[model samples]
Target: MFIELDFQDNGKQSNYQAISTLAQLGYDGVVFSRTINDVITKNDICTFKELDLKELDQNENSSFKNLSSLTLMKNEKKQFRQYSRLNIIISSKKNIFLLKKMENILKTYDIVAVFPQSTEIFEKCIDLPTIDIISFDLSLKYLIKIKYKQVNKAIINGLFFEIRYSSMFKTKQSQARKNTFSNAINVVKYTKGKNLLIASGANDPINLRGPYDVMNMATFFNIPFNQAKNILTANSESVISHGVMRKTYFGVIKVEDKKKIPKELEESTDEDEDEDKNKEEIEIEKEEMMIEKN
Candidate 1:
């Protein structure tokens, strides 16, 4: 299923509208991201709490008209899932400490992404398993060069690189657009298209694009058509899967699987048991022969 993993709530549009647009464009899921600063601010917290209370009260209303239209859309033939993520923009060592303190709360979200503002922060983030995506500010290219070693290490550690297409359209300046394109190409080059994810990062419905349209746009960065397609589909799915795994116990135990084990896997398990049994028997026979000789 096609997914867009970064939709910012910028007050220009309601999440319901943005999600409706995404569903219409054939997206199966959209992750709504809120920056750490916004989430931590007192005013924002109060506002969000008020809104939450209002929504809860509305839900209690018996009238069907008071129900969220998004619920109806979800029940439709094409199902759309909405997920929430917390994006931490790490700039200072102090911010890292703050994140450590808030890490437990952050883990409550479906995904937690880190946007490192400096090379030092980026290096530290490469080793952080809690952070799913290393999101760069794709609006402009920074002076710091990202080394291939760091990107490769992150890939080995199961961290994904995120490129937001919405940043390119946010600006009218040609130079900003150039910088965005250049930074994206540099990231794609360093990562070698492995563990690379392309997302809308859209703040409004107008900025969102269809899955195929996003694939076409990705090719502009010299990415192969097949790889670009995977960025939207397979790679994005992997990111979500990793996010889901992160919140589980040791990133291994998902909800207990109810389905029967595959025949091939069951057969392999049986074969492994038989091999162990035969090795034990052979050792026992060798010991017996040695005792007789003695």
Candidate 2:
């Protein structure tokens, strides 16, 4: 499974320490969600094939030139090539100039997806190639509204939810599980497009869930197990593999602390896993009952 780290655009924790931790946690790629403002040190930026959209401006030709310049400057030493993939998220106002700029950006980078938050912008860019709407947490009702409004023309390729905030908001993990299941079901019912991506708005490694756990969550939602696996692994891998970001570590998981899995998640699975376990218990009970009756 291909795991990707959710790094805030502002580069809040964009450091080698942070990247190293994600690499250790089994993230294959890193998606820069917003405009990363801070200048990361050379060592940190070299960690993986990371992405940024700050250069996506309205000037079509200038945008490509600008991307090339940034790539040249940031990866002159080919530090980014060591990682598996590089990607970009494009979203902006729907002005003609901005549209031109977006076209230019698309020409230069292998855009992983276009994240449109505003209705106006989404309308203008929904038909563009390789675009996906970022589904906010448990906002299935909200997405349903959006799908109806867009007449199913919105070319969303995946769904994403914030694990960090949602987990905290629910306080209990079980509640979070229910919310996740409901959200997925809603999106599946409303979505016209086909890919469903599971992501943690992980500013750091702590936010990521293990591949097995993510799959288990999908199983709980009754989402096809393989499809759920794709959300975290294969889908992200495809994005990174074809994206423009240079690979830094390539295949190696950047090991920092040699950390082990936490005891709680290790011992106990989530709601879906528990349900399967319950099914087994019931089957065993039925067999015992048959034996007694006989």
Candidate 3:
């Protein structure tokens, strides 16, 4: 199944319309991402307002079964799921106070993405475990060359590189597009498309594209066809899984089918047994020594 992990237009469009469009476009799910700064400045109280609306509408319309029969039939063929994500863009030029403020809010979102504006910030982001995705600003003037070591370090820390296609189309300047393409190529080369995520980053309905269209666009960045498919499928799924784990269990989770005692407690119990055995041996030795003295 195909998934779109980043759709930035949740505030602009109704949830019903976006999901309906994605379903028609053959997408199984779409993740809605909003910047923490935007949420704070705009006073955007509800992050998943669209999905909540869909649920409320479904409940209300269920009573009018006959009137909504056609709509229900259309929805039954393709079910589109909605997920919420948060993006945290960082700039090296920012003051230390603001950077600390942003870092404090990292755990509040399902997905925490860092858009590094400089080499220093880029290096720091890769080593951070809370960062789920490293996003590049395709419209920027400077071309930040990605190194293999940094990309590998990011992958090892479970961070995915996010490339937004909408940035390429959003600007009319030729230089911006050229820089975007060049930077993207460098990123793909360094990472070798291992932990890469291709997203539309759609700010409007028109910016949204189907999975095949995105995969075809990946080829333009020199990504192999099979890896392009994985970018939208497996890699995107892995990103979502990591996001969920990060939010639910704080990054690492362990599950056991059988009841297991804590290792620290078991070690303590073993130490107690060892102490008892040592005491018994000492007593026996002392008694033998006493008998020999008698």
Candidate 4:
């Protein structure tokens, strides 16, 4: 499923009206991004559940069920596959190590993202394993310089770099647009379009576009054609998986009695082994194909 990871909030609640529009534009899900301060005064977790929304189920267990009271349309609520994301603001150098202290707090949200305002903050945030995504204020006229070494290190550690196309296309500032293009080009240069997530960070419905349209526009940032599709598909899915795994426990817990195996253990299957093997082969094949094509 194609997921839009960034949508600015209206007041304290998510704008479901705008999110419903995304469903018509070919988006399977939309992530509501909330901004939090440096200090953790409140450990509020995301109310929306993190169930896989590939097949639409509008029941109580539905991922978007939490938004029922926010909007009156019963049919529109299930049309959205929603997840709550927390964007931690890192302004000063001292805030770099804040993740270490907020490990428990971080577990509450479905996804945790950090936006570094300065080079020092960016350098530190890239190495943080607790966070799923690393992004910058690309819409700014003066953007942060992206280094290959840092970008490579982040990718190696299984973190995604976000590209918000919604803001870039809607902004009237020429310098902001130029900076977005230049910064994105430098990012695609280092990572070569791998481990990058393309999202529509739109505040309004007017800023949203179809998934393929966003993928097609990504080439303007110098992303390879094949990899651009993965940015919206595989790469975005990786971020979602990393986010859900942040606080979830998939392993079995040992008990005193050997005969009494927990239901979790009994239900476990090795079906994922072949799937993992296939994924590795597919990824390597894509890399080889892109290398040969280039």
TM-score of each: 0.71, 0.48, 0.70, 0.71
Worst 10 residues of 1 by lDDT: 44-53
Tens-digit lDDT string for candidate 4 (153-267): 6776668888777667787878778888877777677777778888776777778888888877888998767778878878877888988776684222323353554444444
Candidate topping TM-score: 1
Q: Model 1 segments beyond 4 Å from truth?
A: 10-13, 38-78, 250-294
Question: Between which residue pairs do clashes occur in model 3?
Answer: none
**Which lDDT tens digits does candidate 1 get at residues 1-294?**
788889886542266566557766777778877786412322222122111222422443343223343455546754466677778777763355445444556567777788888887787677565668988887765735688767776786789998888877777878778888888888888988999988877787788899889888889887988888888888878887887777664334223243543343333344664565466556656865897999
What is candidate 2's lDDT per residue for 83-126, written digit by digit as tens? Answer: 22112233434231233323433333333233444555544444
* Backbone clashes, candidate 2: 16
Output the worst ten-in-a-row residue range by lDDT, candidate 2: 36-45
Candidates by TM-score, descending order: 1, 4, 3, 2
Give the better candidate number (2 or 4) by TM-score: 4
User: What is the Å distance of residue 92 in model 2 from its true position?
Assistant: 8.7
Q: On residues 1-294, what C-alpha lDDT tens digit does candidate 3 reach at each position?
A: 688777774553344556556665668787877775322322433345435434534544433223242255346774456677777666532321233334435455556676776776676666555568988887676757666766765776678998888877776888887877877787788888789988888766566788888888889899988889988899888988887776566635333333353343233344664565466556656865897999
